[model samples]
Target: MNKLISELRRTALVAGDRVALSGEHEQFTYTGLIVAVDNLAEELSQRGVRRAALIADNSPAWIAVDLACLQAGVALIPIPAFFSAEQLEHTLTSCGADTLISDRRASDAQIASVLAGSTATSAFESQPQFRLWSLAVADQAASLPLGTVKLTYTSGSTGAPKGVCLSADKLFATAAALNTALLATPLQRHLAVLPLATLLENVAGVYAGLLRGAEVILPRVQSLGWAGSSGMEISDLTSCIDHWQPDSAVLLPQILKGLIAIAEQGHWQPPTSLQYLAVGGARVAPEQISQARDLGLPVYEGYGLSECGSVVSLNTPAAERAGSAGKILSHCDVDISDGQVMVKGNVYLGYLGGAELDSNDILATGDIGELDDEGFLWLKGRSKNLLVSSYGRNISPEWPESELLAYAGVGQCLVIGDAEAYCSALIFVTPGYSYEDIGRYIRECNQRLPDYAQIRRWAALPKRLTVADGMLTANGRIKRDVILHTYPELVAHCYPGIVYPIGGSQRAFTPTQTMNSQTDIDT
Candidate 1:
């Protein structure tokens, strides 16, 4: 009884021949798309797959299998390709997934390790692009809430991520709201930029686009220039955008920054066809939004979490505020209680193995924000991330991080000052930017901040924080605890007295000091 599938059926009857999905090697019309879903759903039902996990890159076939699971009334778990082998094993085992659907081979070393305890059979003949494995592991004692359809895991900073159980009704409600939000500039060709495993892209990008009957572009992640979690080739991304000419896309803040760099270089121009480019997954600097607008990129900032069905508020062409997260979506009722953002009306069923919520239950989002007089929701930072300086002054790391990100040279940075004399930063610069460039940027950034919040000492990281190293989540949010645990030396080096051994040509500095003053530290 999924309304989205029913709507897809209705759309197919009228526009059966219209293109619904386009991938690198294949295309599916609306009619063809339905047929594929039906065939796979029938197979899944016959196989008695109560719960299944999907692991694959973005493609038309991936979408087909996803819809198939929905049609078959199977609870689906989507594990991102960027997840470590440990995470993959944890998800499959924790969710009691009876079957696994992936594009990876059964003989793959990582796959083999996770599937070791279970008896599995691959159905590679039926699905050419994907392998279907029936697992015979003991049914887990944990149970999903009644009516749960999709168990989407948040890319948590820890080794074991939690799965947010959601129903079809919740997902479609958010998608419907997103579709309505984009009514002013209807999408014709929507590109899938973020991995479909990401709930934000799955619900907002795919479901919303499909609701509007717009063509959803599903290119391979590599072709889109995605290199794992923290790396991307901006040139390849620009070429994809130029070639696809998509009218709509969802981007992470880093991607938007890269696009701005390309535009500033005058090497490329963003496609005029891109009418709506939604940026989220992190706090986007207002300066970045201004630069994007100046470059003709229709960038809108939105805010949401997986527990709220992926999106709660968005900045649309019709309604937008530069520094705000945007007006709350129609499907959501947001209230600020005790300086925390609480959401109701469109929350999830519950987490995996957790108590299900009643209809009246409110979700404490753990984010600090305020709703303006005009209904725009402006976010401050995460309440859990608020740092208390040694001076007893409260500071939000996101405040200084956002300022650093506004500059083109500063790629990624995290401000740390909890119980410290003053703020310190760990920085990763983009190519062609030197330590002096970053130092100058931080000095300028410090001028705008109060004395307590100003970053006094900084150090260059040997490399960017990446998901593989457990320093960043799949969506590129820094794992503060993991970074603190793994880089104790780097953190020590940022302080006034502590000296730590660091390899590579990295250096720790004060804004006013030259590199020659501090000893060279290598990563």
Candidate 2:
């Protein structure tokens, strides 16, 4: 039996009437949650659901289905709602998922179209404010790693997302480590801000909260102000935080930025009840972290990937550095190899439909980082994203981009200038910021960076990169390749006299350089 499931059973036995989960409209005690998991597990087992895929918003039902799969020893795959239809089709087919559970609002016709020509039958079950469906698909030949309990698909530097297979042991171990790091206890109330499909939130928020027997809040995404992957209503988020008064929450850097903006505008102050606010998913500026702290937000930065079961290191109150990802979690062994971050313990089983990896093999994380004397890990940037200037100077775009992001006006910034004289940026400004204002902000950020890494030129993007636009991963990381492909003209405009190669040596354009007829560049 999974240790997490065993822990859940123990919690139910010890705190039968203690609230385990709460939604916007409903609540469940530990005993009630256990009973629901048993009922759903029985139902799924009777239907021969060896592998199940879940596509739904955050809710009590979503938690129940996930726990039920673990209870029944069934492999569970979580499909991010932000996924494109084509991506979704690829994941469902590649994983050979034999069963699917989704919310009712999800278009049946659309799902059927994605699953068309496959031998699958669907049935609906009525639930409060949400409808559940059980789908039986044709048996697949693909085999999973032994003891596989979850498969999470990540959008790599490719069109098709790859599924990372994981086991309950590794997941629960990480959760326990996080619980210990955060000093979480049964009295903690965790509010789910990120989607439950996100591995970080799933393990760090829900799983860790459950391990501590804390109340996990799983409200609908819309209720918390999220519209798809990129849009947010800060007012709604603050209101929800005020109403829930949660002690813990996980957030992306962008969300943390938004909250800081709200607080800076004197519109709201984060409730004092918020004890632990984990911000990650991208490089965050230390200045932003300081600002959040000054605003009474106990924001901590962490780092991880799906291959590491979500969290490898985190900045707990006990062990934290100002500009580092934090100390390595007790459950994993981390080291720097050839300037790249490598992790060994608690590594993923393997990609779905791929060969299983030896548990002892050190996984080479593409991110480059170093460990401080105090054991705090400082992330530089993705090794693949290292920008080499024409003068043979190497720069990590994330370094300067982080400084740029510290400004209140800049919403999203991508630095790109490989083999060029200096760096340039594609920026998306927060609403109400003018080009001149943003230019001033960039200049201010430039003062904090080296000359070679300063933003020499920049163009304002009409829209922010987002999952809906296929320019961001489901976890909110920018898809650099996708953005470069989608906006070649804009990128070219940033370098009027430079002919940047897509995948080869860079060449200089002729003297009669004619910039693309697009938005004006700020220098």
Candidate 3:
């Protein structure tokens, strides 16, 4: 057995009566958790389910199913609830998943629709808060690496999402390192704010909490203030924190921004019990970090990717730098090669249906970064995301975008303009901001940026970019290609010859006229 499952059994034996998991309608002690996992694993083993797909909201049953898969030695594939129907079908079919466990009736219908042609059998149960389905054929010969235990699909930049194969040891090691790095105590209570489908939350939040024998709050996403990929209710989230008073939580940059806004409004404050909050998923503005600290929120920034099994490095209370992702964890080795961050140790097996990544070969993280003398890693931006101007100057959009996000008015900004005279942006302002307010904030940001990277012109988005709009990934990273394709006319309006009216109208201009006007603006 792997170390994680063994530790979980030991924890259950040692702390049998202690609360191990909690949800909206149920709670489980360590003994209860162990019993639940064993029961489910027995059922799955009896059914000969070698691979199973899990699609459900955060709940005690979700954790139980995940643990049961580990116990049963079945390769588990967690399908994100936010995935499109087509994407979901592709994952299930490509992975040759033999069974599916999901909580929602709507999800059951969706799954049935996807498997309509197959001779699949279905069963409903109330105790586990999910229905079970057995497919007609299982692709017993699915191509996967040996010892593959988990298949996490990435929110792809284009086409269907790819599955990232990971071993149990790699994931457990990450969790154990995180638990040690954060100084997690057995008494600690962790709130699951992000979905379990997110590897970061799965490894660092759920796994770490289990490793420490900590009580994990596993409420559904809606109960935690998440509406969709990009929408959140700050008031609802603050209420959850105040009520739960969890010792630790993991968050994305946008979620932290929302909480900071509530704190700044004096409507809420970090609960005294809240000790460690790790923020990642995107580049956070240093100023925002300072603001969070000023608000008495222990917000620490970190960095990682799915290929690295979620967390590569993190900011712990014991060792932290303001703008860095913190020192690389003991589980991984990080180095910068020609401006790209390379990772070794605890790396993933590889993408499913693709080349098997050799562990000996250093995993070239597409992100650019630098390691400080203190061993802290600071990320610059994605290497491929660099924007080159007609003047041959290369600029990272994240640099200027981070500066823009520092302002309260700017909710999100996408900097673009490759081969153009000057840089331009598509700005998405927070509610209650006027055109003038956004423009003033942009000007302020422009002052801080280099001339080549300054936003000479920009247009406010009609609405926020969201997963529904195909503009953001499930974890909140911007889908640059989707945005560019979805709004070509709006992006073009940022150029000099094209005019964006105050009422949000687009007008095109002649190429020669546009070039001359842009040259003048550049000068």
Q: Which candidate's TM-score is highest?
A: 1
lDDT of 1 by residue, 247-340 (tens): 9999877688778988999998988898889988777778879989999898999989899998999998799888999989999899999999
Q: Estimate the Cα RMSD of every predicted model relative to the unseen true structure.
A: 11.5, 11.8, 12.1
| Per-residue C-alpha lDDT of model 3 across residues 1-523, encoded as one tens digit per residue | 8788788889988889989999998999998988888888887887788988888889888888898899999999998765656667778878888787777664364465765654434443325456667755445435888778999975443235678899998899899888778774333799999888888889889998988999999888888887644457878888898888898899877678778988999989788898888887776778888899899888888888788888988887788888888889889999899999999988889888777876685799888899998789998777697664533334677777888889888888798876465678777769987656766677776665545567777766667888886789999999887676666665666774545333233232222444334322221
Question: For candidate 2, what is the lDDT?
Answer: 0.78
Instruction: List runs of model 2 lying over 4 Å from the truth.
Output: 105-112, 115-141, 184-187, 386-523
lDDT string, candidate 2, 8-38, tens digits: 9999998889999999777889999988888
Best lDDT among the predictions, by candidate number: 1
- Compared with the true structure, the alpha-carbon lDDT of candidate 1 equals 0.81
- Give lDDT per model, in order: 0.81, 0.78, 0.77
Give stretches of model 1 more than 4 Å off. Answer: 117-126, 138-141, 386-523
TM-score of 2: 0.74
Whole-structure CA lDDT of model 3: 0.77
